[model samples]
Target: MNFTDIDPDKLFSSTDNSNPIMWLVWIVPIVVFMFYGQRIQLQITSGEISKNIAKLVKYKEESKKELLDYLQTNLKATPDAAKKIDGFLEYFTIMPVDFDPNGIIPKIKHLLRSREDYTRQQVKSLSPNMDALEVSKVQNLLEVTTSLHLLHKLVRHLFLTAKKQNNFPLILPLQMMIPFIMEQASALRDAVSALKQGQPIGDGIGPMVVGKMMLGTEKKTITFETVCAEKEFEQRKLYLLKAEGPTATVGRPGDAVELLVLKNKPDIIVMIDAALKLEGEDSGSVAQGFGAAIGGIGTDRFQIEEIATKNNIPIYAVVIKQSVKEAITLMTKQISDKAESVESQVFQIILENTKPNQSALIVGVGNTLGVPQ
Candidate 1:
C-alpha cells in the first residue's frame, strides 16, 4: 500500500474492528511481558527459598554434630550408642501421634512413657560407665537438639514445597509463620544452652521451688525414678515431691504423689507448675488457684485428680506464668527471681487452707532439668 493510502487515524482507532491485526499488535507484547515476568518472578522466589532451605539444613547438621560431640565427651557414648540415641531422638521429635480430643492425654502419656523407657534403656546400655546424672544430661541435650532439628526440617520442607509449586499465596503464609518458627527455634537454642550448662529451665521453676523447700531435708525414693522429702512449714508438715533432677525428666511425680497420699494422707494437695502466660501477662508472675497446674499428656494431672478426689483432698494450684516460648526454654532471670515470691505465696496458701499440724502434699509438676530433690 502506498504511504498516502495508509491513514494514521484508521491505524490507531479502536472502533475500527475490520482489521484484527491492529488488536493483536497491541495485545501481543503485553501478554508476552506478563508471561515472561511471571516466570522470572518464580525463578527468583524459588532460588531465594532454596537458599533458605540450604541454610536450615546446614543448621540442623551443625546442631546434630554438637549433640554428638556432647554425648561422646560427657557420656563416653560409643558410636552405636550415639546412633541409638539419634534414632530415639528422631522418633520422639517426629511424634507420630496427631492431636485428638478424646483420650488424647492417656495416649500421649503412654507414648511418652514408652519412649522414656526405651531411651533410658538405650542410654544405660550405651553409656554403662556414666551415672544417672550424666545419662539425664545426655537425654536433655538430645531433646533440645531434636527440637531444633525438627523445626529446621519442617521450615525447610515448607519452603521447598512453596517454591516447587511456584505459589506466591502459599509462600506468603509460610513467610508470615516465620516469626513463630524463629521464636521456637530461639527457645530451643536457649534450652540447649541451659541443658549443657546444667542450669534450670523456666519450666523447672516449680521443681526449683520444691528443691529449695526441701533443702537440708531427707529425701526418700518414692518411685523407681522419683523422690520425696518432708519439710516443716507454718506448723504444717509438708511433703515435697519432685523428680530427682539435675537431669531432664518429669520423674513420675504423679506416681510419687500417689504413694505419698497413701502413706502420708495429707489434708491438702498443692501442685505448682509453670503455666503459659497470655500475651499481656508478665513472665514469672505467680497465680494461685485450684486444679492441677501440670502440663503434658493428662496422665499426671488425671492421676492427681483421681487420687485427690478419692481421698477428699482439696487440690490447690500455684503457677508461675511464662510464655509458651519461655516455658520450654532456659530459665530467665525473671523466672528465677520469682521463685522466692512463689514460694512465699505457696506457703501462704498452705497456711490459709490448712490447719496447724495438718499434713500437706506439695507436688512440683514439671521437668526437673537442673533442680534436685
Candidate 2:
C-alpha cells in the first residue's frame, strides 16, 4: 500500500475493457447532461410562451362564460337559444371562416340570418320584453365575443400542442407571434364591450360620412336594407350607398353598386373604407387609390370588380388608415374628427377623377354600427 508498491498503469487499467462498470462510469454523466440540457432548453424557450397561452385561454373562457351568463340573465335567452349559440360556437371553434371567393357573401348572409334568428328567439322568450333593436345589438355583441373567444382558444391550442411535443424550434416563432395575437384579442374584447353599449367603431368612419351625405336626400333601398341617396356635389350627381344601420350589418354593397351601375350607368365608381395602418402610418390618415376598398371574404370585391370592368368604369378607392385595434374598437376622437377631413378628400377625389355633371356611384364600406343613415 506504500507509494513504492503503486503502479500508475495497473491502477488505471485494473478493470477489463469489456467491464460494464467501466462503460457506466463513462456514459452515465453524459446521459445525465443531455437530460438536464433538454430540461433547461424547455424552461428557457417555453416558460413565457406557456404562461401567455394559459393567460389567453383563461381570458377566453371567462369572457365566453360571462357573455353567456349575460345573454341568459339580461337577454333572457332560452334553452333553445343556448343550443343555437352552442352550435354557432362549435362551428366557429371547429372551422373558422376565412377569405374565400366562391359564394362567400351568401354564406355570410346565411350566418347573419341564423344569428339574428337565434337572437330574436331569445328576445321573444323574455319576460320583461325587449325590442328588436335591442336584440340586434345583443346579437352583434355575441358575435364579437365568439370571435374573440375563438381566436384566443385557437392560439392556446397551438401553443399547448407545441409545448407537449417539446418542440423548441416550433415554439420560438409562436412565442414571437403571441404578442400580436394577444393585442388583437384585447382589441376584440374592447370591441365587444363597445358593441354591447351600442357605440360605433373606427371602421364606421366611412359609413358615418356616407350617412351624413344621405341626410336631406331621398334614400332608395337597394339590397339587404342597403340604401343609396343621390345628391349633387360640385355639379356632379353623387350617389352615396351605405347599409341602413344603427343596427349591425355591412349591407350588400356589391349588389347595391351593381344595381346602381345598371340603373344609373355612373361614369365612375368610388369606394371608401377603413384600411389597416402600418407602424409608421397615423390613424385617421386618408389615402386615395384605385380598385375596391372593401374588406371581407372577397365576394364583395369580386362583384364590384366584375361590374366595373363590364361597365368600363374607373374604380377609385379612398381609405382611412387605422390600426387593427382602432378599427374594431370604439371610434376614437381622432377618427371621429377626421370624418369631415375624409369627406373632403373624397369630394376632392371625385371632382378630380370625374368630369363635371357626370354621375358617380360612391359606396362606403364597413360595419355601420352606431352610424345612422
C-alpha RMSD for every candidate = 6.3, 7.0
Instruction: Return the top candidate by TM-score.
Output: 2
- For model 2, residues 158-229, the per-residue Cα lDDT tens digits are 777777887767666776788898888777666767777778988888899999888899887888759889
lDDT (CA) per prediction: 0.79, 0.78
Show the colliding residue pairs in model 1: none
Q: How far off is residue 269 in model 1, in Å?
A: 1.8
Candidate 2: segments with Cα more than 4 A from true spot: 1-38, 72-74, 79-83, 92-132
| Model 2 residue 291 CA deviation in Å | 1.0
Query: In candidate 2, which residue pairs clash?
Result: none
Model 1, span 213-234: residue lDDT tens: 9989998888956788998887
Error of 2 at 213 (Å): 0.9
